[model samples]
Target: MEKTNTVITIGRQFGSAGREIGYKVAKDLGIKLYDKEMLDRAAKESGICQELFETHDEKPTNSFLYSLVMDTYSLGYSSGSYTDMPINHKVFLAQFDAIKKIADEGPCILVGRCADYALEEYDNVLSVFIHADLNARIRRIARIYDLTDAKAKDMINKTDKKRSSYYNYYTNKRWGDAVSYDVSLNSSLLGIDGTAEAIKRLVEIKENNNNKKL
Candidate 1:
């Protein structure tokens, strides 16, 4: 593994083999990889309820008047102190801070939670989207999670809907859309390892181009 000054963010469909791919890429790059661990850490740091974080984490956009909530949270106008901050606002701030902290640490791979959109303006960032065919995804989910085919199909649809809504709500862009990502892969075709290798190659090429300009 070689070190590079770029961070990779992956947005993936459930059962699309994104976590495995992201981990492999991070392993190959010798940089940290963040996923659920981020939520756990944010919960600990913010002193907010973990379940609230989990519930709202990567959740669909809220129509709760964000500006009003943010203003109240900012002014410390809840119960008494910032501790009185609404769970939603606290979770949002926690994740937002965590993202910045991770980026400050060094190059790494981040999965989910609209991470690509979070760091969209950063100079050294690569965003990826991964998806698989519906049947392929259903089968994979069924086998891995031990669910009936119909149940698996339902789960897939629900999960994707939640993820899409969450992403679109936060990013204002279509989920799994190629335009929002630097690379989009059909995991059903290439499989997890192949997708990782492809991304590794793309990262290498991108790094080389960056080096040339530097």
Candidate 2:
């Protein structure tokens, strides 16, 4: 299939195999996938330390403070004031800019870090959310991490909470909501490869429809 200038942003629940699916999609499409690598790029581009990005990764902060920092960013930051801004705000903006820069580079698969919200205004963006049944997620996490079921379940809840909080805090929409994405899939139903193939089909359909309109 002829590739379109499309950017795929995937939002996923913890232990849903979303990252694996994203990798497969990118490989199948012969494109790059951005996950943790995005943080490296963001840190390099923003001149922030990479450790900070890791520390604040998918973590939420006070909404009011976020607004304040964003407003300061808009107005232009003085050296002293910028230094005083919350670290979470700085990391979020850095990642936000990195996401835009990545999209501008060309077709790619971006996993999480609110990539969909970051590229909301772009024309050729497809946002997808991946979720699975709780039991399935628990089993996947347990198997992958070599943890007991109880520990795996605990990690899943904690990780999902952070992701959801981060997404909701940064974007106006709710995380994991059907209306927030172009499509939401259950990874357990189709397995990792099948889910990736399904997303590829959606991308093809979207590209064809867009081409017809053009």
Clashes of each: 0, 0
TM-score of each: 0.87, 0.92
Error of 2 at 112 (Å): 0.5
**lDDT string, candidate 2, 111-131, tens digits:** 999999999999899999999
lDDT of 1 by residue, 61-156 (tens): 556676566555566454555565556666877887788778878999999987887787787888999999989999999999999999999998
Sequence-dependent TM-score of model 1: 0.87
The per-model lDDT (C-alpha) reads: 0.84, 0.92
Best by lDDT: 2
Q: What lDDT score is found at residue 205 in candidate 2?
A: 95
In model 1, which residue pairs have backbone atoms overlapping below 3 Å? none
Off by over 4 Å in 2: 62-83
